[model samples]
Structure formats: C-alpha cells, structure tokens
Target chain A: MSFFGPGHGACPGCGLTIATRNVLEALEGKCFVSNSTGCLEIVSSQYERSAWGVPYIHSLFENAAAVAAGIELALKALKRTDEGKVVVFAGDGATADIGIGPLSGMLDRNHDVIYICLDNEAYQNTGNQQSGLTPTGSNTTTMPAGELMPGKTGRKKDMISIAVGHGIPYVATATVAFYADLRRKVKKAAEIEGAKYIQIHTPCVTGWGIDGKQTLESARLAFETALYPIIEYENGELTKVRKIKDRKPVEEYLRIQRRFRHLFKHPKGQEIIRILQKIADDNAAKFNLDV
Target chain B: MKKVVRGFYSIAHSVKLCKPNVIAAYPITPQTEIVENLAKMYSNGELGDCEYVTAESEFGAASILVGASAAGARTFTATCSQGLVLMSEVLLNAAGMRLPIVIVNTNRALSAPLSIWNDHQDSMLLRDGGLIQIHVETNQEAHDMVPLAFKVAENPRVMLPFMVNMDGFKLTHAYEPVDLLDQEIVDSFLPPYEPPVYMTTKNPLTFGSYAPPHCYAEFRVTLQNAMMRALDEIEKAYKDWAEITGRYWGGHAVGEYTDDAELVVVSMGSLTGMVRDVVNEMRREGKKVGLLKLRTFRPFPVKEVRNALKNANKILVFERAVSFGYEGPVGIEVKSAIFGFTPEFYSFAVGLGGRDVPREEIVKIIGDVYEGKVEQGFHFGTIKEFEEVVV
Candidate 1:
C-alpha cells in the first residue's frame, strides 16, 4: 500500500505527500490525473520519476478543473469515460481560491470526473501564506501574530456546502487522519456520474508548526473539536456525516498547533475558543450535523 | 432555392441545417430571434438529437457551449456585443483548446453609454483570437456562411473554430428571403465533428497544460500556423460546397468584384452590400472603379488584397469601427498587411458607433480619392461642409 516509501522529497512529515500517495494507492485502474501547480506537484514531480504512480498531468492553478474537464470529455469521445476516474489533485490555493469557476462549471455540466482538494490551510507551497481556507486566529506569514487582532480576518469558507449547491451527485469531506474514510469517499465519488468533489484536511507541518509525527493527531483534532466539521452532501442535499467518537473543546484543538498559538497569548483564551465554538455551531446549524 | 425570410430567421434556418448536437444559447437583442427560433427548432424535433440549454446568463451560455463542444458534440451559440465580451475568456479557451466550435456573432456596438446598434467592434476586437472570422453581407450570405464556417473550423488541418459575424439590428432583425440549402446537402457537406480528445477520466490526455516558456512560445506560434492553414481549408470547403449549390457565395476568399480598375474600395460585413451598390452605380457612369469585399478577416488575405489592389492607383478602406486615438482598426491592419508595397491608400474611418454612412458618401469617397482631394492617409469619412457625405 505504501508505494511511496520513506525516501521522498517532501518535508519529513509532509501530510500532503502522504495523503496524495495514499489517495492514489486505492486506484485499481489506470487513471489520468490533472495536478494543480502547488506543493504536491512541486515536491512529487521533481524532473523524471514523478512520485505519481499513475498517469498524472498538471495545468495552471485556475484551469485545473477545466483541464480535467477536457480530459474527461476526451475519454467520453473514445468511449473510455468509464474505464478510469479522471481526477484533479489540487490544494486550497487552486480549489476554493482560483479554480472555483471551472470546478463549478464542471459540476453543473455533469462532467464525469472526481476533483480532490488537498486543504493544508494557507498557500503552503508559496511559503506559509494565507489562503481562503485559512481559519481565523491562525497566524501565517501574511496574517502575522499580533496583539490587537487575530491572524485571518474571517473564518474558513464553507467549500463543501458550495460544492453541494452545484448539485453534483457526490460531495464529501475527509482528512488524512482517516485513511479508510478518505479512500472510501474518493472511490464512491469516482463510481458515480457527473462531477464529484472531496475536501481533505491535511495539516501542513511547517505552516502548522507542529511535531511531524503529530500530523494524524492534528487532523483528528480538527474533527473532534468540530473546528473542521466533516460532512457530505449527495445530489445537492445533506446525506452523511462522519461520527466523532469524543468531541473535545475548540481550545484543545487550537492550543496544539503553533499557528493557533496567538490565541493562547491570553491565559483565559475564552474569546477565541468561543469563536471556534461559534464556527462549529454555525456549521451544525447550517448542515444540521448530527454526528 | 430561395425563400423569403428575416435576417435572424436566415441564421436560424441555416443552424437547423447543420444540426448541431448541442445548442447552448441565451437570447440577447439584435440576436435573440435566432436563438428563440433555434430553441423552438430544437424542441419540435425539427432539429433532432440536440441539447438546447436556455442558459441563465451569457456567461453560462458560453460556458455551457464550451462544455457541450468539448464533450465531442457539434455545438452552436449566438451572442451580441455585451454577451460576446462577457464570454471573452471562454471564447479564448474554446479557440486555444481547438474546439472547432462555430458561434454566430450578431455584431453590436459595445456599451458604456449603452448603445445597441450595428457595428463591427465586437468581432474586430476578437480579430487576434485564434479563430477564422467570416463577415456576411446579405441574409442569404448569413445563411450560406454558417455551413461553410463549420466545415472550415472542423478541418483536420485547421481545427480553428469560426465565428460568423452579421451586423446586429441592421441584419439580425431585417427580414429577407434566402435560398435555404437542403439539410441533406448541409449534412453531407459538413461531417459531424469528432475532436481528437474529449472530457473523460479514461485515457486522460493533457489539455491546456502550461508549456514551460519555451514550449509555450512554440505552442502559440504553432497555433498561428494553424490559423494560416485554415485559409486553404476554408477555400477547399468553399470548393466542395459550390459543387452542391452551384453557387460560390464565398465569392472570393477575399472578395473582389471588379478588381481590374483604376480605384478600389474595401468593406466587410453588411457594409459590403452597400459598397457593391455604389460600385455598380460608378460602373454605369464609365468610371473605372472596383470593390474589394473582405470575407475572411482572421487569415487576413494580404496576398489576395495586394493582387486585387495591384492595378488600382487609389485604394480606399471604409471601416465600421475605430481604434480610438488611431486610424480605423481595419485600415491599420490593411495598411500593415500591404506594408512594403506602395499604393495610394486613403483610410476612411467611417460609420463608427452606429453612425450612418449613406451610399452617396461611398460614391463621394471614390470621387474624392480619384480627384486627389482626399487625404493620402487615414480620414474619418469627413466631408467638406460643401456637402454631407453620401453612403
């Protein structure tokens, strides 16, 4: 299963590399993939032997979805649209930020493909810069640790909800922590008609300033604290939610990562904790997350 | 073979003949009637096996057409000035991807002060886009242009999509009878579009990949070469189409009605019809004059133009749009096209922003150019207050 062994160009505990390698491991068929120009592409595709085990291509940041859409149509003309799942491997910088129009168009037009958004918060490939998915109170290079206010101005955008609104048949949320769930979600998405979107939370080690080995735990914390609630919408409606065994307070989640260390500047940490709680509460109200 | 029809209906009827598998268009004035007729044509089984998406916006209409075209379907869409500008990005994407999509552009004036009238600004603005642009004059020409456009665009050697342009309100709403071609002939002439690749997860090929600076530059140059190849492909299509209809309405790839004369006038789009009338009047008067009607602008048939103007002493260019702060765009291009070769060129930048250019003005232009009264370079169709310039 671990075709990408220890010797890799990625950072010691780069969650994205692990997640992408693990993500491709489930493919039993020869699939064509479009990779967005980001950290995943830069590290994995160094010159000759791209870490990609399958046929992987790359395009511009904004046109990732459009490129994949083209490949999908090409397969259909050849009567091979169903042979393998055409997927786009892009990050938050490419997905929610730039490639939204093409992605939304593909979903609406019902292109037969799967698009995976490997969310590592900020634009990690460009050196710990803020992105649309970067949450509030998280200090990055742009949103510096300051005394007056927090790191990111607003909360992370509701991407999964927007994807659902596009009326794609399958839309889900997963994390690198839950390998089994991530694989299952991707597989399920590929086996359907029309475009599918899956958002995976892979904590960036350098950006998050956390222990490399603690990547999985950080992913788990995102879910347990409900800071990054995992939910799915099928055919434009709420259909599934991943069950969290023991929900923890948002403080326990934020206090672990150095990115969120700014919130701990005050001992009480009451306001930032409530803000995280409000995010979770809003999501719960919005999607009615039972699990 | 002729039937009485409105300009817009001519376009709609011609679209029906091609039988586009997907017709994604939203109605906008000066161009709405055609799609309205098409939406009906698609719905009534007259145009069979087509997906007619009544899009929410011009942007959606454009994107939908791109998706449908990429999905290996022969697609059609119609838009005017604002709509065309709104769909600008997808238009570039469509041509860049070599989609071979044939779209109808009802040429309308771009708005800021919000004026919707006949102008070539819309199509002229897209002259640099990698697509064959054919301007049609009459309703019959509009009808005839569609079939040939599809054939040229989908040519394997020149897989550049084409946009057939007609003056908006001037032509789109003007009802005129056209000798519509038999659908069987159109079907036989225009074979179904089969793109080299389409959207599929299986056997995915790289499309729209960022070629590192070196490859990127080469790709652009190659695209330019393909556009050049389309000239021959379009001529070939015209040759084949002529056999069926016994009419080569494409006339000259770069039109020249009476080229072997003292002076030559140039025009494109419905304006050509006006030029033709003026030329006929001048011919009867024993005045040795000719008219060069530009049909295909993208390939910019410089060689043909030079040859047509070879015998002529004075060559006048009547442009419908201005480049602002410069001479007319068409005049500039025509001048650049014939750069090294010297000709007594008079660029009459006229009929801009829906301003009317009467036939008398056209006659006066020929008279002035011949008399050595007109400026040697660009003129804004200005007339001496001695008289109002006629067409």
Candidate 2:
C-alpha cells in the first residue's frame, strides 16, 4: 500500500511533496510518522481529510524530534517494537532554527528513530522568511535585498555536520533531484539502529521564485554546483560521497532563482557571486566532491 | 501500608501503583524529588513495562508525554514555576489533542525577584489552558490525587490532560504519614488504559490535524464539553477510590463547619489546612466561622462552592497568586460562581512568595472582615517590610 495518499494541498511541482513521497515509499514495514507544523503537515492533514495512509501525528513545530523519541520509547515500553519504525518529517526551520534543542536531546538519548529534515532553505510555510538554512546572498522576506544590505549575509548552517557532531549511528544528505539516491539513503538509514538524521534538500518553488517545472532542475543545480553536498556518515565517520561530474558554475544555479536575482544586478553582485563560488569550492575541497 | 515519607515520595509511590507506560520529566526545584524517586523505582525494577526518560527541558518533557499519550500509552510528567511556564505551549497541545496525560505540579512562586518557594502562581497561570486542575490540601491528598487524576483524565467521557497541584515547599518537602494503597486495590480502581483511538498501523488514524476557521471553534467546543463532563468523572473516580480505599478527600469542594455559619473562608492548596485551624479556634470562641476548601480549580466546582458558601453572610476568598491587574484567579472564579447570592465578598492575596501565613494572620483577616475594617473588594494580607538596601 502507498504510504502517502493523494489530494494533498501541496502546490504543483512542490519539491517537498516529491521528497516526502520518495522517503515514505522507501520504508519497508509498518511505520508511524510524527510531523512538525509546516507546509508538509498543513497540506497533508487538513482536518477530516488527511493525505497520510499511515498512522501519523503533528504536535508542535519545535518538538517533533522529542515527540518521536517519546513514540519510540513508548513502543518499546509497550513491547511493540515489531509494530513499526517511528519517523519524523520536519522543515529546515523546525530542524535547524527553533527545534535544535529538542533535536539535540533526541540525539543525546540515542532513541531508535529516524529524523528527516525536509530542508526548503527558508520558512516557506510562513512566507519566505529567512531561516538558519537560508543560503547567503539569497533574498527572503525577512532578509530582503535592500541598498544597505544585499540579502542574508551569512552562509547556510551545515546541519549535516551538526548531526554528525552528535555522533549518531547514521547521518545522510540528499535532494529531491536524485530520487533513487534519496530512497537508497532512507532505506539504508532505516536498517541502522540508534538515532539517525537525514536532511533532504527540497527546493521551494514559491519561496525560491522558480518555475513550477524547474523545481527538480533547481535542486540538481544546487548539487551540480557543489553548493549542496550529497554525503553520508556512518558511526560518525564519513562513509560515502556522491561525486560531482562536469561541475557547473555557481552563477548557473543563481541566475534562475529570483531570490538570487539581486546578486547578479547589484554593483557588488559579481563580488558576491565570487564569494558564493569560493564557498562551493570550500565545500568541494572539504568533502572531496570531485569525480 | 502506613509510612511516614516525604510528600514527593508518597506521590512517587502512588504513581508506581498506577502503572504508567511512559514517564518523562526534567528536574526543577521541589518537583525534582518526585521524578528522582520514580527513577530510583525504575532502577530497582519496581516499575514494570515503563520507559522512564530524563528529558532535556520541561517543554521536551511535556511534548514527550503528548506523543506517548497519543500513541495509546499512559504517560506522566511533573513541573512547576518556570518549568510549568515553559511547558505551557505543549500543555495546551496535549489538551487540544485530548491526550489523557497526568502531571504533578508542585506549585511554586513565579520568578521576578526569583524565589523558589511555595505559592499557587505557577498552576494559576495555566488556569485557562484546558487541563483539569486539582489542588491538594495535604501530603496524603497529594498522594491520593495521582491515580484519581489519571482515572478522570483517561475516562473516555473526559479524555483531557490532568494537573495535580500541591504546594511546593509546604507539601512537597514535608513528611507525613500516608496510607498507601495496595497494588491490587489500585489495579482494581484504575484499570489499564484503553484509548478509544490511538496511533496504530492497523487503524492508521491521524491526530492533531490542522483545523480551519470553519471547524476550529467546534473542536474547542468539544474540548470544553469534555471538561464539563470531567466534573462528573472526577466525582465518580473519587467515589470509586473511596470505595476501595475508604478515603475521600471531599468531591470537588470540601466543607468544614460550613453549615449555619455566619462567615466562610474559601481557599485552596495546603493553605486551607491553616485556615481550617483558625476556623476551629474561632468556633470554640463562639464565632460562627467556617472553611470551604476548593479541590478542583479548572472546572471551578462552581455549584459545590456556591452551595457550601450560600448560607454564610460574609465570604472571604484567600489565594496565594494574584491576577495582577485584576484579583486572585480562584477569587475571581469564586465571585463569579456566587455573584448574586453573596452580599459581602472579600478577596485576599496572602502568603505570596512563600511568606509565612501564620494562624494569627488568618484570624486577623477574619477579625478585620467581621469588624468592618476590611472593604468588600480584593486585599493583600500579611504584607511585611523588606530590609532596605542602598544599591
């Protein structure tokens, strides 16, 4: 049976929907889902009509990981470990911003659950606000590109490194552009035991100001430009890396999205683009992303 | 079995008898010992089939209980003061989702000048948070209210969260002889929790769904109706426990010397004990004074409170917490409960921030009211001068 049903309120070509479907489809047996208050929860479970075909719950925004820990422990206490694996689906804002404390708590306790961060960069549910995962030089509602400031001035938070720093059993990064790899990472993480974190780069079509048809392309460009790395860690050691072939320039990824349009138009736009390229070069050098 | 133990220990023993599936909490002041004792019991293998998790914060603790309860498990946690304030958001979520979780709130003073002492400020702040709130007057009552709270909260008619409030330093730190209920008797009184709908693969149900303006009010109305239904459920649980244990701490609102009394003093929590003593002393001196102890604060026990105080000519409500711009929370509710029936009503905020509420103070307040020295509005009792410091 399909894990996620139809009639969700997700926008057309929504990368979040694509990534969520891929992750849920990868699960093997019975599963329970704990969702944070975001686009995924709002679109999927609207009152009496729910798009979830599995047992699901949505508590608050910042407590999804803690709630999942509780579900996992309750299952063990009830002697129902064979019932299902507990999973959490949260946004980048919920994972890297308001939810970091509870996320750290869940990891510290090493609860047997998988936490999936559907990273849409910004707070898309709240109308394109700047979140901890919002990349530098990207314009958002909270960090608009004005004459005084170009856009967000800081780099995107390395949430994968933060997860790895917890020394969890499994940590992986994926994007909606690579569906097969995304599913493989989820399936692999599900096989492991202790706390697991997987952050998926799901591009927001509305928030990114990209065409509905260009969602997958935007995610792919993010990976091809080495701006978003596809890497995995096992036992706190870097285990695998998806090598980039025929690397694309950072401008190819920046020029298409309106959030980054200011980066090309401003007088110091090229300077900022050069800085973004230097960031990608640093990521490539750090993760050895070259094929 | 009768044993002299700390109030927190008695509560832990009572919770052990209840057999909760999940217990998650963080340590905070007077509320720490209860969870510490429970953790010790878990280590000793006395708590069976329980997952005891030490949460990072009170917010995480309350959220953990929310998920555990939603997953068809009986769950519990404890917090007070700032911890309660931190858990306020999740507490509302638990109530809104109709999770039958029980929490012990060792009522303490809220921080401004920062004092960790006994007061009703903590639980009073969440008065409208939709949890079924009960205030205990003694250690024994605190011990008994655990299973009683779970019984009412898990009742299918009233699937709401329950908070058992006991004065922080007054009841939590004091040692008292409590007749602990036997495991078999507790088992008979509170059956294993059977949730009507929970997260299960076979059922595949959705919980905590997004509600639009068209139906949000309806969900709130449903919760409010369940709270109203809890009034009867609380009474039934008390009767059932009393049948098995032969100890009843009065249903909702308890009365002492209230019949044909000229003056009635209304209060809650451990402060009622001191007020009861003052009432007894006044009675011996030929003064017709009585005491009305409010047991349940959320539903307010409006009918019972009105019935107990209607015969009295003058009603004095004393509370440890104030509503700041308004008056005491319980006093506000009590006034509204008996608005037309009472002609002389006086509300007093006393013993705030764990200041001593001696019997003399209670007697003095009563004297002032009877002698026409106190007005018909809210008053602050037992105000003392602080040492002047040149900063």
Candidate 3:
C-alpha cells in the first residue's frame, strides 16, 4: 500500500523506512499509528511533509506503547474499536531502552494494540549513540572502540523474552529482508485482539556504516548467522521459527559493517568475534533456527 | 448538593460529574486518594461508562491520557511531586499536540531529601509548558475548576492541555464543604470532547510532526498565542459556568479585594485563603491592606494584576516555593507583570518544604513591608529564623 508513501526523508535503502512501509502495507491503511521519536518519526513525518497516509501521531520517545494503549482504550471508550487497529511504531532505543518501562506497562494492561520495534540497534536519530539494543562487539558513538575498552561491552537486551514474559497475546521478530514473513507477522499481530509486539531487525545504512544498497543484505546476514532469529510466539508460547536454510558464520555478518571493523583488527578482535559466533550458535541452539 | 468531603474526594467527585471517558493514573501520595475514589466510583458503577486504568508509572498514566485524548476522549489524570516531574515530558507533548487533556496536579515538593510535602515546586516547573494552569485556594474552587478547565482547554481558540493545582496534603488531605454540581449541569457545561485533530480511521491526519526550524517557531508562536487567548476563554468558561451553577469567583483571574486598600499582598494556591484571612484581620483593625489572589498563573493575567496592584503604596508577595538563587517563581512573575509600578516591593519565599506559614508571619511580613524594613529581593519568611541551616 502507498499509505506509507515515498519521498520520505530517510537515507537511501534505509531498512527502517522499508520496515515501517512493510508494517503499514501489512495493515493496509486500516490502522491508527502512534510513532515514537526516532529515525522513522524524524524522516517520515517532518513538518508539513508526511509520508504517512494513515492516521498517525508522533508523541515523545519513551511513551509510544503507552500512547497507543491510550488510543486503543479511547477507541473502545468511543465504541470505535471497529474503526481500525492501533499500532505503535518505535525504535529499539524506544522499545528496549528509555521506553521499556512504558512498553511493559502497555503489555501489562493488555491494551488491544500492536507495538513494532524497528531495531537499528542504536540511537540513530541522535547520530548513533549507544543504546541498550546496541549489540556487544558493535561500536556506537558513545561506545566507541578504544584502547581502554572494546565496543559496547554488554550483550543486547533480550526484548523479545521481556515481551513474552508479559504474557501478551502475540510477539514476533522479523527483518526487512524477510518481507513476506514481516508482513505476515504484522498483519497477524494487527488482527489479534490483545497486546502484540514485533521487533524488526532494521539495519541503518548511515549508522551501521554500510553501503545503502547493502541494507537488505546486512539484515539478511543478521538472520542467516542466527544473530537475529526470525521467530514468533503466541500467548507466551513459541509458535513458529524461521529456520536458517544456509547458516553463515557471524564474521560474514560482521565483516561488512564498519562498527565491527575494529573487532577484526585488534589483538582481542578475533576472540571477540569468536564470542559473537558463540552467541549466534547459542541463539541457533535455543531457537532451533538451523535447518 | 453540598457535601463535607476531603479535598481529593472533592476532586474525584467533580471529575465524576464531568464523566470523563478515561481516567488513567499511577498511585502517588496525596493525589492517590483522588484516583482511589475514582476507581471505587468506577467499580461501584457510580461513575458511569469510564475506563479507569491503573498505570504502572506516572509516565504510563500521563502517556495513556495523551493517547486517549488524541483519540478523541475526554481524559483525566491526577499526579504530584515526582509523578508530576515524571510526567513532565508528556505534559509538554500533550500541550504541543493540543490534546486538551485535563490533569489535576496536587502540588508537592521535589526530591533529593525525598520530601512528599506540599510545595509549589512541581507546578511551577511547568509554568511555560503551554497549558492553562489554574491554582485554586479552596477545595471547592479545585472542584469547581475541573469542568471549567476542560471547557477552557478544549476551547477551539485554546486547544491546550489544562492543569489544576491544589496543594498536596495541605489541601488534598483537608476537609471542606463543597457544593458539587450535578452530572446534568457538568455534562451540559462540558460537552463531549471533540478534537479537530485526532487519530481516526475515517479521517486520517498526522499529529506531532517534526517541524523544521522555520515551522517549529511558528508552532511555538501559535501555542504562545493560544495560551494568551486562554485568559479570555477561561473568563468565558467562568461566565458560562456561573450562569448555570450560580457560583462565580471574580473574573480578574480570581477575586481581587484590592479596591479600597493602601497595601496589597499577593499569593497563589491554598496560601491565598490564609492571606485573605490576614487581610480581613487588617481591615477590621483599620489597616488599608488587601489581598490579590492569583488563580491563573499561566497567561499570567498581567493587565489584571497591574490594575489591581497599581494603586497600592506597597505590595508584599508570598510564594510557597523558591526558584533557588532567584526570587520565588510567583514573585518573579509578579515582578515582571508590575515592572514599572513604583510600589515598595517585597518578595518573600514562605512555607517551603511544607513548613507552616503562621498567620502572625503574614501579618509581620505585611507590617515589615509597610514600615520599609524588608529588602527587595527574595526573602525567606519563616525560614529566616533558621537561616544558617536553611541556606
């Protein structure tokens, strides 16, 4: 659907732009959206020019889920729930960092709304600052690779598990490369009657220091290495897992992005890469992603 | 119907009368009773057709109201102290989006000694947040102001959020006899909230968009103009509300008893009641002292204040919160409003951190200001005795 219109102020091949478009397309203009302050909000709805044809609101960074919850309840209060589904479009920073509390609140209240986290893994809107979702061994502006310390020291937060733990009706993870899978998940989540969450592995061309054309390729690599598993859950139960038909080593995924360039060159680089590989292996083992 | 009720219950009863479709709140002290009563009313089916959400945090409470308001519902919330500070970001967002959500802010001191005491610090922090801030002295006024606040805030000319501030614990826990309006009057006075901008499937529109520097300034100017226009809108609401309810606080941003006075005392919130009492005592004693109570702090009522205070030989200002290293927030605003007036000015910071502002001190402060004793800048009223410890 062209509801998520073109000519948005996003970087070329920005996976977030693609991801948001896919979500809106999946909804097919039958939803009211609440956007958090992030790359998507900044790029798509700047002033007089709006890329969204659907009803939308961009209110604060950390309260998209909370706002969407209100929208859902308000719709119910007005006896207008049949009007459209309510959805929150936010970033990893919004869903996993500062906004996590409000997101948790929304899920706990079980508002009939869908929350989508476009996980670019850093604060791309603020020029690549470190976020809770910035994976370990990855370099962000605030977590620069230095002589004293490596990249982001800790592993990325397990936001999926957090959402699932809330006992919400539906939770899923998708990527821009898996358009059909992403659209299918978004549509299914929107159709569900209770709180839902979808975390899409959105790759940032500018923030990730990758060529714009490699946006999909990078997102695909993230899944192929089992670093970001494309999985779905219903009512706290794992329902489906997108098996990796051809698994690649984490290095293939890391090598293309400059954020991990220091990991390949430093004396401790190889060890860090091995640890990252182990992480992917663990994810694969846990989610049964390997074919 | 008049009932003897705690201040928080009065707030709850008033909100119930307005029949807000959504009331989202996170439990915070002093303000908790208001939501507690609201939840009870919802459960008992006394407050009909309302969704009461017990949000996880103050942020959740405020954000829920913002979303609910944007989705075209008459939304309400109650919070104070840390809760108000926590809701600060959304407070700004609610105004910027012109959502017209009504929030009752039970004023309390901020933390770092972690005090839950009554103070003006919380509401004063959001003075410029593009909301119609109405600070009421009595529980009755707090109750009366809710529907009027909604009317003013939702006015097409002033599509801004509204905050009604009552002193936490001091007023929220105090008991008062309030003549509550019936649901019929409330419903008629405050029509179902219908916003021009909202998230509806039938008519799609984007709200809270990113404005470039050029567009951002215009939006801010619009908000400023809207806030300015709120003064008249608020008066109009008062007039309409008075016609139906047969109750009207004077139109000059609250009652001004300054017509036949040689000296005038200024204050806001619950402090005004005591200030009025002191003025009455002085009047009986043949002293020409009167009180100017500020009800609408935002849109500051500059002209009314100047008119009421211009004739006085001296003006004494008492405020409940300090801005730290400067005059009290209300005193500073009063100074800015009456800039050219030649009255002997004394700005006193009193009752901070919930310290009692004894009636004698108010009398003494007035006496000092009249006798040319008090200094011009920020004066610590009762805390002056414990200067070493306070400073």
- Chain B TM-score (model 1 vs. true structure): 0.93
Worst 10 residues of 2 chain B by lDDT: B334-343
Query: Which structure is stronger by lDDT: 1 or 2?
Result: 2
lDDT of 2 by residue, B50-134 (tens): 9999998999999888888989999989899999999999999999999998999999999998989988999988989899999
**Candidate 3 residues B342-374, lDDT tens each?**
877778888878888788988898878766787
User: Can you give the TM-score per candidate against the true fold?
Assistant: 0.84, 0.98, 0.97
Candidate 1's residue-wise lDDT over A41-129, tens digit each?
77765434355555565545565676566556545544554557777788997888876776776677777778889999989998888
Residue pairs in clash, model 2: none
lDDT of each: 0.76, 0.91, 0.88
* Model 2 global lDDT (CA atoms, 0 to 1): 0.91
In lDDT terms, how accurate is model 3? Answer: 0.88
Please report the candidate that would top TM-score against the real structure: 2
Best by DockQ: 3
DockQ for each numbered candidate: 0.21, 0.86, 0.88
Model 3: residues >4 Å from true position, as ranges?
B254-257, B384-391
Clashing pairs in 3: A47-B210
